[model samples]
Target: MLRITAGKLANALRGTVSGTSRVAAVRCLHGTEESAEEFDKRYEKYFSREGIDGWEIRKGMNDLLGMDLVPSPKIIEAGLRAARRVNDIALAIRWLEGCKDKCGDHQATLYPFLLEKISPTLKELGVPTIEELGYDKPELALKSVYDL
Candidate 1:
């Protein structure tokens, strides 16, 4: 019995098998290091582009929020503006939550700053803040866990 992979089969057919899987993973696009400001600007531009759709808005917000540092206010404003333009109020709210989550322990300070910075845009775009949406205090579990 013998086992040969598709790569080997292809190589044999082509008269050579340099081999596959064992090849060292090459790092693509090691061009330059991106700064936090540049990263923020990139995402801001993505959301601020005219005629951006819901899917692109979600993807851009998600990818930006998934990064380590919290998104800057300008970026969040752009995303919120885009979300409203795309008529996605839910996505706009979700992005607010994502930004809050990314704030970690500094949420006490930074979150308010973020809200303040984006409040005008949110209002202009007719998007509600998490508090205005009543999501600032979730009451799904009324009593303490010990009550359960």
Candidate 2:
């Protein structure tokens, strides 16, 4: 009969693998610590390829927003523009909502700024404009867009 305890097996496996491999340190940037140039590089590296559509943009933004990181207004604007290019404004709005919920004032401030930037495009798409919705607050404006 062979009897091997879990501890003995773990110790044997540990001995077989070397712990000398260097593990890269992960640095997380928040607030203004991350620069616009760095954000541009990341966006270009991931989504600047030809034939990249809304699905890819949404997926990429989802991954970026999933991280415990806060992006600058320029980065968020770039993401919105990418979404608009693929006619995924709804998804972009949802992403901004999620960011507003998670990041509070910083994202809240950006929501309206982005809405203004995209309002003309949204009107062209037959979606209700922010002014037409009679909502000055970004949160309400977003809700109106969702309802459409």
Best by lDDT: 1
TM-scores of the models, in the order given:
0.73, 0.48
Candidate 1: which stretches are off by over 4 Å? 1-30, 145-148
> What TM-score quantifies how close candidate 2 is to the native fold?
0.48
Instruction: Estimate the lDDT of model 1.
Output: 0.78
Pairs that collide, model 2: none
lDDT of 2 by residue, 37-134 (tens): 77557765666556788878878778667655565555555566676677775766665665555565665576576666655655555455334554
Lowest summed lDDT across 10 adjacent residues in model 1 is found at 21-30
Which digits, one per residue and each the tens of the lDDT, describe model 1 over residues 34-140? Answer: 66677677778888888888988888877666555688888888888898888888888999999999999999999999988988888888888888878888769
Clashes of each: 0, 0
What do the candidate models score in CA lDDT, each in turn? 0.78, 0.60
lDDT of predicted model 2: 0.60
Off by over 4 Å in 2: 1-36, 105-148
